[model samples]
Target: MEIGSSESQSECNLSIKLGMEFDSDEHAYDYYNEYASAIGFSIRKEYANKNNAQGM
Candidate 1:
């Protein structure tokens, strides 16, 4: 999920919280294959967009 905080200098934070069930082999494989890059890109894009907006 994307979070914004005024106290955070970077303006945005990305966090991945994994539960024990998600640590299972089946879930881990799916997470690495399907969700990892999308999550990474979402955080990166959101931060970049916010930065650009702030600059303008």
Candidate 2:
């Protein structure tokens, strides 16, 4: 998956300069959650349907 600044990157004041690869989506989510929590941020899970191109 690609990691880049969101449209409001400036508002967040955080930047990710590295790329990460995971064996599965669950793994990625866990890693992200841990990182966010460690850095005093919160995140939520949103499911995307493969059939829904618009979601992608």
| lDDT against the true structure, each candidate | 0.42, 0.62
Question: Which pairs clash in model 2?
Answer: none
lDDT measured at residue 55 in model 2 versus the true structure, 0 to 100: 53
Question: Taking the tens digit of each residue's C-alpha lDDT, what string does model 1 give over 1-56?
Answer: 25223234243333345553565766655555444444433212222343565674
RMSDs, each prediction? 16.2, 9.1
Compare the candidates by lDDT and give the number of the best one: 2
Number of clashing pairs, model 1?
Answer: 0
TM-score on alpha carbons, each prediction: 0.26, 0.52
Q: Where in model 2 is the C-alpha error above 4 Å?
A: 1-17, 49-56
Candidate 2 lDDT, 1-56, residue by residue in tens: 23433444345443444586779989877877766655556799986567565655
